[model samples]
Target chain A: MRFGSIIKVALRALLRNTMRSILTALGIIIGVGAVIAMVSIGNGAKAQVEAQVASLGQNVITVFSGSMSSGGMRGGWGSAPTLTIEDAEAIEREVTGIVGVSPEVRDRNQVLANGLNWNTSVNGESPDYPDIRSWKIASGAMFSDQDVRSVAKVCVIGKTVADQLFANGDPVGQTLRIRNIPFKILGVLDSKGFNLFGQDQDDAVLVPYTSHMKRLSRRTNISSILIQAASADVIDKVQKDITEVLTQRRKGREPDFTVRNQVELAQTATATTQTMTLLLAAIASVSLLVGGIGIMNIMLVSVTERTREIGIRLAIGAHGSDVLMQFLIEATILSSLGGVIGILLGIGSSQLVSHLNGWPVLVSTASVVIAFVFSAAVGMFFGFYPARKAAQLDPIDALRYE
Target chain B: MPPVVKIEEIHKIYESGEVPVHAVRGVTLEIERGDFVALMGASGSGKSTLMNLLGCLDRPTRGRYLLDGIDVSQLDRNALADIRNQKLGFVFQGFNLLARTTALENVELPMLYGARKFTTKQIRERAMHCLDIVGLSQRFDHFPSQLSGGQQQRVAIARALVNEPQVLLADEPTGNLDTRTSAEVMGVFQKLNDEGITIVMVTHELDIAHFCKRNLILRDGVLVRDESVSNRSFAATELEKLSSAEAAAKLTGAKS
Candidate 1:
């Protein structure tokens, strides 16, 4: 018979058993929905990690002093004083791949602005600090190099500090007291949002490192160093150069410091996110397998129920392939319907979850296509046995069946 | 002249476990073009087996069977299906119309299976003509469930005649209908036979068997009698008289 007639027959038969068809399609619906939802959540988590790593800035390296032991005391909270302003200056002047360098000395203290006091970390650094860390001034202007040279009391406030210290007033060129010392706010840094580590980037204060050491603390030592490479391609070489310089400055005691490259951090985060995506997809694949099994079961039942109809068709001059194609088409229609419903549910559920949890959910076209194709394949793979069985049935025996 | 169907010493054995049950022992029969014949037998008398063999639905075990001059017993299953589609049409006791299809579509089914590339309008026109022949022109779009037993049988007859095959083989066509409905269906067969189309029917009712011009009676896998029914014409008056008599007998029996 014609292909259209066969499709019409299959569709009619499926509609005859509406409840059963819907129930069978539910398997595929759940399977595709799980796949999309899981992938979206996994991708969301990966994006969160990516944003965290990107917050550190590309082509940048962070150097921190290694922990130290007190004299004859194990497990002491002492840290080696290896990083210094001189080391930072040497890297900037001698390293071929160095773009900018900033030595930082940080301390936490209560700050008073217009009689509204708040406790926040104050980081003392040079004019290149914002450049090395990829922080931009949202308003006013960044502290100039002349301010660092002249031990100027100008400072830059983070968004959180700006919000807490000034409320509705513009903090630019306003005086704020840090550890009882009055300082003028030069600018407010842009918001960097929150990261995976839950650290709020908009809650610190920046000032000239030289002034903080000489005038505020009466010390010339630096705690950490931030270095920006000329480009991502030369990050490793620049890191090696900085390591050598720090080692030499520390008197060959293995530099007593650790260097962290943002490239490595970003790569690790990417690998972690991809692994998570695969793992979630794998878990979702189990549902597809179960859906396949459901299709197989339903097809087998359909074969049994339609044995007489099959016999009638065969008696009326239908070939075995026609019978096989009819059943196969029925299976395909069932699963395809399930796939469409599942896609809608998956997208809606992902959006709902994202809204409720305040997490980012991504639904890529690739995921949608993959889920739909997989569901159809599952239908075919599971529908084959029943179709073959129907094709192989003896016409006489099938007609004789009640 | 080419014979419509020829069976030569055909044997069919049914195996139930290790024992063999011979359904058709060694019987040969020939039906010519435009001949209206009936196979009469009780249950398990092998007449149904002979019909199946003639229809190319089952192969003879040790003999040759030719349908429209082709040796159908030697052909493969697919070849047999092709022959059935091209040369033979069938009606069954159960009126096996696809339950969900409309009457018109069911009538159009065999033509769809044929090799002719007919447009949708042509197919519908032909199907409507066939339905008109079977006196079901008004119920073209009704499903099988919506029709009565007699209407469903007429629809089945329409389906059988849609392809205009060389032979129409009906196995107990009126087995499920009442006596009046059965006579009405037999009238359709008689009219088609008068139009020079060959028909071979299997029926157990002697009254129904008298409708055909020839009869082949089977007894225990063998032909007991094959005779021409010269004075057994199926006149409408005779059928009405017989049906009234049957109804009167049933009424008297019920009263007793």
Candidate 2:
């Protein structure tokens, strides 16, 4: 018989048992839906992480102080003694690829402004800190180099601090109490949202390093050094240059600080997100496999149920291949329908999840297409054995079936 | 004259447990073109087995069978299927119509499967013509469940005739119908035979067998008798006489 006629016959037969057909398709629907939804969630999380990392300045590098031990007892919780303001200045002077550098000292303290009080951490750094870390002054102006040189009692507040303390009023050119000492608010930093560690980058305060050390904390040494390359591609060269410069400046003290590149940080975050996505997708694929088995089981039953019909067709004139094609087409149609429905359901579920939880959920077209194609392939692979059995039946015996 | 169907020393054995049951033992038969023949047998006489072999549905265990000078016994499964499509049409006692399909589509099925060059339009036209021959032209769109038992059998007959095969094989075609419906279906068979279509039917009813021109009786997997039914009685004429007598009795009762 013609292939078109066989397909039509198969479709008609399937339509005859509408409930059974829909039930069979449900397996595929769940399988494909789970795959798409899980992968989209994973992709969305990865994108959110990437966006946070990008906000920290993709071209910037951070070097944190290692632990210091004296008399076999760890020193007090302070900046590493080996690093200093001089080291930061020397790196700035000697490093060839470095565009800017900032020596940082951080401390958590309570601040009061306009009778509203909020506890927040403060970063003590050079005038180059804002540019190197990609922070922009949203209002007013940044503290100048003269402020660091003169130990000026001036600071910049982040948006979160401004929102809590100032409350819709401009805090620039105003004074806020830091550790019960008066400090003038020089500017407000733009919002930076949250980082991968879930810390709000926009909730802190910034001050000149000399003033913070001499006036507030009474400390002299620095904690970490922040540097920015000209672009993302120059980060490696910039790292090597800084390492060499710091080594020479510390009199070759075997590099007492840890320099972390943006590439490594990005890669670590990406690996973690990718592993999560893959694990989720693998678990969902188990359902797809189960769906395949479901199809096989149902097809076997269908072949047995239609044995008499098959026999009659064969007795009339249908070839074995014709019978095989008919059953296979039936299976393909069932799976394809299931796949389409599953895709729609998955997208809908993802959107619903995002809406309910207020979390980012991204759906990729490639993943949807892959899931659908895989479902169809699963149908063919699972439907083959039953179709073969149907095709190989003896016409006489089949006709005699009760 | 070339025979439409020829069987020579055909043997069919069925394996039952440890013993082999002989279904057909050295049965030989010849059926000429355009001859309406009947095979008469009681239950378990192996007449169905012989019909299965003649229809090319089963291979003979031994001996040669030829249909239109082609040795079907030696042919493979696919070749046998081709022969059935091109040369033979079958009608079963149960009126095996696809329950979901219309009468016209059912009749078009064989033509669709056979190696013919006819277009879909031509196939439908031929199917309608065959339904007309069986007096079911108006019921072409009706499903099998919508038709009576005799009408379904007539539809089966139309399906068998749509392919214009060399032989028509019917296994107890009127076995499921009442006396009146059976006579109506037999009338269709008589009319088709008069148009020079060869038919071979299996029947246990003597009255139904009398409708054919020849009869072959089987017992214990062998042909016991083969006779010409040139002067057998027909049930239709006998029923006509009975109905006329009833009508006359009704008139006499009214006069009294």
Candidate 3:
């Protein structure tokens, strides 16, 4: 029997009952659609998280100052200010692959400038703060090491701070008062989008750690330390060396800090979303199975309904394999058709979601192909039994079937 | 010029529940090329069973049956199907034209399943020619449902002849038609027979059997009678006389 002719016959049979064919394929359509939508949305969320992690800088490592369990007291991360300038300086000198280090001290303060007042975070850092954070200076310059050593009253302003304090003027060479203490503006930092924690990173002030420790919100210990490795290849070695140096600095005392790398952070951030995508895909796959079952059900009913037709074909000299091929091809075409429509539905719904909810969505070609091939496979898998049953039917019995 | 069909002591036994029922017992027959034969019997006489055996739809349990001298009685299912495709044509009582399919496509079905591949144009041309032979060329595109009963049976005949089989086996070809339509269908069969196409028909009606050149009677799984038909009915004359009778009745009814 000719393959093309068999397919043509199957198509003709399906067209005979167009409404039933469409209804039978609906299960596969919805199933593939759900899977595509969920995968796109989940991948979009993951990509956003990875981008945020990357924004923290390439080959970057940070030592967070809490996770301390000492003397019947448990302190969570960022709660205890155990890290200090001395520890940051020690790691900078001891670690060989490090290119830059910044002692970080964070506090919230209200500042007044040009008769306007706004409340924002105050960050204290070294001259290498911009490089370690991948933050660029929009104008003017960063505070120099001389400024740090001399405890000069100078600070750089984030874009939000610059916009707020000097709406009509350049922020450089302006004086902003923190706790009524006047500080000269050195430069304006470029805009950085919100971070993984949903904090507006651009809404803050930058100052020398020395000046912050001595003059404003004076505190003893620094909040954390940020370090930049020379390259991605040396990140793990640099991270290991920093952990050893910090652990040695404690001198057998309970370790009060956690060492983390941006790569690790990115993995941790995207893990949940990847798993969610798989979970949604798995749930969607269940619907595909249901869709396959639907195909099998309809095919079985069709086989019974067309028993006399099968009889006629067999009587007219069609081989059993020909009858089998006819029905199987019909099933595969129905499912593949559904798969295509589902992919379109998925892309459209994902796009609609992204447009309406502002959630990032990534629809890859690989997933579309997989969904299509999978639905086709499902159709064949479910189509085989009924097709075989039709093929094995006795022509005499089938001819007499009412 | 071997005989188209020759069966020697063909026997068919069916294992129905417990007691083995012998459907055809020691039946021997020969049908030559271009011959028209009618196998006739009452219900339960196994004539249908013998017809099935000749069509190769079922294999006989014991015998040497040669279809166009091919010795097909012991062949497997697939081989038998191939033989049926290449050498035999079948028409059923129900005018088994595939419903919803146009007459042309219906006729093209057998060619699609044949052992030799045919180009689409070739298949279409052959099917159209067969339909033309059946005098249904104008109705080639009409579906079976759209055609009248006689027309549908004619389409079935076209389908049967599309493959140009050695023998055409029709099981009650005009069973579903009225008397005039039966005569009309029989006339088509006669016309085809005159063109040297062999035909075998199964019928219980004596008048229907008289249309064939030979009559075969099976009684209780046995061939009790086989005789060359005398004064065999010619469908064309019978149809003409019926039409004249109808015209006369119409005149009388109008006068009344």
* The candidate that achieves the highest lDDT relative to the unseen native structure: 3
Q: What is the TM-score of chain B alone in each candidate?
A: 0.92, 0.92, 0.96
| Model 1 lDDT, residue A390, Cα | 98
TM-score on alpha carbons, each prediction: 0.92, 0.94, 0.93
What digit string (tens of lDDT, one per residue) describes model 1 on residues B136-175?
9999999999999999999988888877889999999999
Relative to the true structure, how large is the alpha-carbon lDDT of every model?
0.86, 0.88, 0.91
Off by over 4 Å in 1: A66-78, A217-219, A240-255, B114-116, B239-256
lDDT by residue (A266-292, candidate 2, tens digit) is 889988999999999999989988888
DockQ of 1: 0.53
Candidate order, TM-score descending: 2, 3, 1
Of 2 and 3, which scores higher on TM-score? 2
User: Per-model i-RMS in Å?
Assistant: 1.4, 0.8, 0.8
For candidate 3, write residues B87-125 as lDDT tens digits.
889999998888888999999999989788889999999
Q: For model 1, state the Cα shift of residue A188 in Å.
A: 2.2
For residues A1-402, could you state the per-residue lDDT of candidate 3 as single tens digits? 798888888898889899999999999999999999999999999998888888888889989997666797877896787888889989988999998999888889999999999999998999998998888999999999999999999999999988887899998998999999999999999999799888899899999999999898688888788999999999999999998999999999888888889898888889988998999999998999999999999999999999999999999999999999999999999999999999999999999999999999999899999999999999999999999999999888888899
Off by over 4 Å in 2: A73-79, B232-256
Clashing pairs in 1: none
The TM-score that candidate 1 achieves is 0.92
